[model samples]
Target: MSPSSCAVLCAAVLSPCAIAQTSSSPSVPAQVAGQLPTIEIRANQDEARADLEAEQALTPGGVSLVDGESLRQRSVVTVGDMLRYVPGLWTASGSTGDSSFISSRGSNLDATNYDGNGIKYLQDGLPVSAADGNNHNRQPNPLAASHAVVARGANALTYGASTLGGAIDFTTPTARDGAPNELLLQLGSHGQRQGSVTLGKVVGSFDGLVSAETRRFEGYRLHQKQERSSLYANGGWQLGDAVHTRFFATTIDNQQQLPGPLTRQQWLDDPRQAEAAAVAGNYRYNVDTWRLANKTVWDIDADSKLTFGLSYENQQFYHPIVYAPPFFSLLIDTEQRTLGSTVRYQRRMGSHDLLVGMNLARTTVDGGNFSYVPGGAQTLSTSVANRASSLELFVMDRWQFAPNWTAVYGAQGVSTRREVRDSNLKGDFNSINPRAGLIHQLSPSNQLFANVSRVYEAPTFYELQDQTPGAPPNTLLEAMRGTVFEVGTRGKQELGSRNRWNWDVAVYHTRLRDEILSRDNPTAPGTSLSINADRTVHAGIEALVGASFALGGSSAHRIEPMVNLTLNHFRFRGDSTYGNNVLPAAPKVAVKGEVLYRHADTGFFFGPTFDLVSSRYADFSNTYRVDSYALWGLRAGWTGKDWDVFAEARNLANKNHVSQFSVRDVASANAAILSPGEPRSLYVGARLKF
Candidate 1:
C-alpha cells in the first residue's frame, strides 16, 4: 500500500469517469442555421492504421503491441500467456513444460542465458535463441502468432544483436485484399484440443499466405501431457508503383511432459506428491524452427524512400532436467544460424520528417549435452560452440512545431562480438543510445506524450559458462547492467450521444549495475544448487481505464468497461542474498477487470474477467511466502459475416494456487517447494472467413 498510495487510489476511482467525459454535450444536425459554415474533420485510420500507429509512436524504444485481436481475446496460450500484461515483464510457470522462466527489468533467472542477460529471440525477424552453452528452450506455437512486439528496458537499438530483455517481435500473417479462406476448431478442459487452417492467393505478381496449427493438452498434473504444431508462409510482390517485394516462412513442432516439484512435507502432505519417483519415466520436449525473410521497397525520389531487408534462421531443442539417483537423464541439442541485413531511409522537409537506419547481424551456435548416469550408467558428452556479430546505426527526426506541437529525436550506435568454444571466452561491446520525444495536442480528441531513453545490456553463453555439472549448475552468476526511466500518458474522449472514454498512465524507474543473482545451496540433506546473485532495484506504476456505452439501442447494443493496474517496487539494492528483500518473484499487486457486451447488428458477444495477484516471495531470503490469488473468467461470442464463434472459462475458482517456488535441502531445515496452479478450464472455438 504505497506506490503513491496505489496511484492515489487509482486517481480517485477515475475521477467520476473524468468528470462525466468533460461535461459532455455535442451533437446537432438540422442543416441550415446561417447557411454557409461547414467544417468537420475526423478521418485517419488507413495507411495501415496510420502507418502502424506512427510506427508505434516514433519507435526508438519501449514498444508493446500484442494484437491478433488481443490474442484471440485473451485466450493466449503460453509465452506465459503472451507476456502476462507486459510492463517490466516477468513470468514463471513451473510444474513442468521445462519450468518456464522469463525476466526483465530487475534481471536474474540466470541472467537471461544465451550467454548472460543479453536477451534476444525473434520469430518474424529471425534469430531464434541458441548459440551453444545450452539455454535451449525455443517453443513457439502460440497458434503460430500473427502479432507480438515487445521491446523495453534495454532499447533494442534497431535489433542487431541481443538487447537484454528488449526485443521480441513476432508477426506472421499476410495477404488480404478480399481474403481467401480460413478455418479453426477447438475444445477444452484439461483434455484440450485445437486445429486451424488458413490460405490466401493471388499468383501472377505473387501475394500469398498460408497457415496451420494444432494443439493438445491433458495437463493439470498427474503425468502431464502436451503437444503443438505449426506452419506458416507469406509472400508479396509489385515491382511497380515505387517497387516492392516480400517473403517469409515458419515451422514448429513440440511435445511436452514433466511434472516436478513438491517438498514442504510433500506440500503439507499430498499436494499430489510426485517430485520424482520416476513419474513414469520419459518426460519429453522437442522443438524445431525455421524462418526466412526478404523485403525491398525503393522510391528514392519525391520525398525519398528506400528500404531493404534480408533474414534467415534455424533452431532446434530437445530437453530434460533431473537431480540424482536413477533419475539423471539429460540430453540437449541445439543448432542456430542467422544472417540479417537492413537499410532504411525516408525523408521529407519543410515540416521535417526523416529516418535513417543500418543494421547487420550474423550468428551461429552448435551445441551438445548428454548424460545418463545414476544407475543407467555411462554416457557423457559436451561440445559447445557460439559466434555472434552485430552492428547498428540509426537516426530519426520529426519536427512540426505547431498545429499543436510535436518533436522527436533519436540516435543509436551499437557494436558487438562474441565468440566462445569451450572456454576460450571472448566478448566485446560498445554502445551509444539517445532519444527524446514530445507530442501535444490537448484537445480535439486529446493527446500528450513524452519520452527519454538510453539503454544497454550484454553477457550470455549462460553468463559465460559459470559452471557445468550435469545440469543444475551455477557458480555465482554475473554480468548484468541497466538503467531505464519513463513517463507516460494517453487519452481519448467523447461521451454523450453514445459514450466513449479511454485513459492510460505510466511511470517507471530501474537501476542496476551488475545485478544478477540466483543462489541456493544446501548440499547434503535434500540437495540444492540454483546459483547467481548480485544487486538490484526496480520501480513501477501503470494504469489503464476504458469505457464505451450505447445500451439504449435502436438495435445496436453495446457495453464495455475495462480496468488494469499494476504497482511494483522491487528492491535488493546490492545483494547479500537480498539485502532489502522484496525482489524475489516480485508481484506487489496486479489487477485486471473487463466486461464487454456487444450486439452491433447481430454479431453478439459477452464477457467477464477478473484476475488479481499480490503476495510473493519465493527466496532471496524473504523467508518463503506465496499466497494471494483471485481469478475468474468467462466469455462468449458469435460474429457472423465471415464467421466466428467462441466460449472460454479459466480458473473459475477451484483454487489451490502456488505457481512456483523453490528451496529444499531437508534432513533438518531449508524446505519449501511448491508449484501448483492450474485447475478448472474450458475453451470452445470457431472462426472462418472467405
Candidate 2:
C-alpha cells in the first residue's frame, strides 16, 4: 500500500474484525488432514494499539490518534514539530533546546515557558505534569513514542483529566507493534546531528524494548547550543491468562544555552544575533531526570477489566538569568520528587459501557535562588520548599439508546493542595465538573456529535509566586473555572470504490472567571508575571481534512491533498484594566496545507507543505502588533520493509519573519520581545532495521 493511503486509514483499519481471526465450522466435527504436524505456539498476543484506537473512537468530541510511523518519514525533532497536523493547537519553538510555547483552545496563550496549567499530559495513562500543574518539554520523547492520542475538552474525562485544554497521551511501542533491533541517524543544517539504537524482542511470555539516543545542535541563532542524551526501556510479562504486568524506566540529561528575545529592529537587522543581556550573564538551562513506573491490568471477567499503575520521578533543574538591578544575576537551583498512581475499572452491560477511574499524585520541591558575583561570595536571595498534592475521581457512561444514536454522561471531582514553607503561603482548591454529549451516526462510517462541559484549573506555583523585582508573590491568586460548549463531526467516506477521505471539524466557546494572564512590563528588565483577570471569553473553530485518490486513472500513481485551519476569538470580559480587548500572542487565523504524490511500486512519496499565520496583538492594550507571515517547505522520502530515507527543506523562500513573540504591556526601544524565525535549512535522515 502507498504511504499516503496508509495515512488516511492508520486508525480506521483497527476495527474489531481486522485484528481477530475466527475459525469456521463446528469444533466437535473437524476433518483431519494427513498427519498434521503439531505446531508449538509461544508468543505474546498483545494488541495494545488497536485497543487504544477502539477506545478513542467512542469519544463524542474532537479527538485524534496520530500515527508515529507516518511521522517518522519527516524531519521531526521536537514535540512542537510533531503536532503540526493537529488543528487548534499552537506550538511555537524558542531556541534549539528550549521548551516551545504550547496552547490549545486559547488556553495559556501568552505563556512562554513551562506552562501546562490548562492541559494535562500523560505517558501510558500516568501523569507527567507535577501535582502543582507545572510541566516542561522533557518527558515522552517524540522519537520513542509509537503513537499519540489527543482528547479535546471534556472528552478527556475518560482518562481522569479535568482541564480546559484536555489531555495528550503518548504510548510506547511494544514487541507486538513490530519493534525490533534498529539504528537511526539524522544530519541537518547548523551543525545538527542525532543518532539512536533500539532493541526489541519477545521471548516466551515476556516482551521487552529499549532505546538509547544522543543529540546535539549548534542552533540557528548565536549562543544557542544544545546537547542531550536519553535512555528508555519497558518490559511486560504475562502473569496469567487474565493478568499482565508492565514496567518502564527512563533517564535524560540535557543542557542548552539561552538566546533571549530581541527587539523588532534588532531582529530585522540581524536575526541570528543573541540578546546582549543573555550573553552577559552566560544564561543557560540544564536538567537531569530519572523515572520509574509499573502498570498491571486484570481481566476481572468476560465483560469487565481493571487497571492500576504507580510511578515515581526525580528531577533537578539549573537556570541562570541576567537582569538589571542591585542583584546583578540570579542563579536558581531546584530539585523535585513526584509520586503518582491510577486506578480504573471498565465494564460493558448490554448496549451501555461504563468507566470509573481515580488518579492521585504528590510532588515536593527543594529549591533556592542566589546572586552571582565574579570572584566574590554568593549571596542568598530566597529559599523555596513546597509540596503539592492532587486527587481526582471520575465516572462516565455511554448508552446506545437507539440503533443510530448514543448519549454520553460523565462527571469528575478534583482536589488540589499546595504548601509553601519558605514563604508561609498555603492554598486548597476543590471542584466538581460534569459533562454531557450526544452522538448520531449518519452512516456506517459517519458520525456527528455535540457536548457541554465544565472545567476548573488551579494556579501553579510559578504563577502564584513572583521572581522579578518589585513584584511580590500574590497569595490571592484564585483558581480559574469555566464552562465549555462544543459541537463537531468526524468520519470517513469512500468515493468510487478506490478513493477515500477522512475529516474532522469542531467549534467551541468557553467562558472563564478569574482567568490568569501573564503581562510583560516594558519598564522591567525581565519577562512579565501572572495576574488574575476578572472574566474572559475564548472561542475557536478547528477543521482538518485529507483525501487520497488515484492519479490519471492509474492505480500505481496516487495523490493526497490535506488542509487544516484554526480560527480563534479570545477577549477579556468587562475588566477594570482592559474591557473586551483581544488576548495577545494568539493569531486570529492559522492555516496549513499539503500536497503529496506517491508511487506504490517503490514506496516513494514527495510533498510540498505551507503554513500561514495572521497578524496578532502584542498586548491587552492592542496598540502594537506583529505582522502576518507565511512559510513554505518540501519533503521527500522512500520506505521499504527494512529501511527508510527522508529529506526535507524548510523556509524555501527564505522569508524573514517573527516566529514567536513575547507578550508585554507596551513595546519600547530597549525591551526586546521578538524571536526570529529560522532561515532556510535542510535536513536528511535514514533508519535501518535488522
Top candidate when judged by lDDT against the true structure: 2
Q: Cα RMSDs of all predictions? A: 24.8, 8.7
What lDDT score goes with residue 690 in model 2? 97
Give the per-residue lDDT of model 1 (tens digit) for 421-454: 7657776655656667666656534456666666
> All candidates' lDDT scores?
0.59, 0.76
**C-alpha TM-scores of all predictions:** 0.31, 0.91
Residue-level lDDT for 228 in candidate 1: 73
Compared with the true structure, model 2 gives a TM-score of 0.91
What lDDT does model 1 reach? 0.59
Which stretches of model 2 miss by more than 4 angstroms?
Answer: 1-48, 137-139, 323-327, 373-377, 465-474, 521-527
Clashing pairs in 2: none
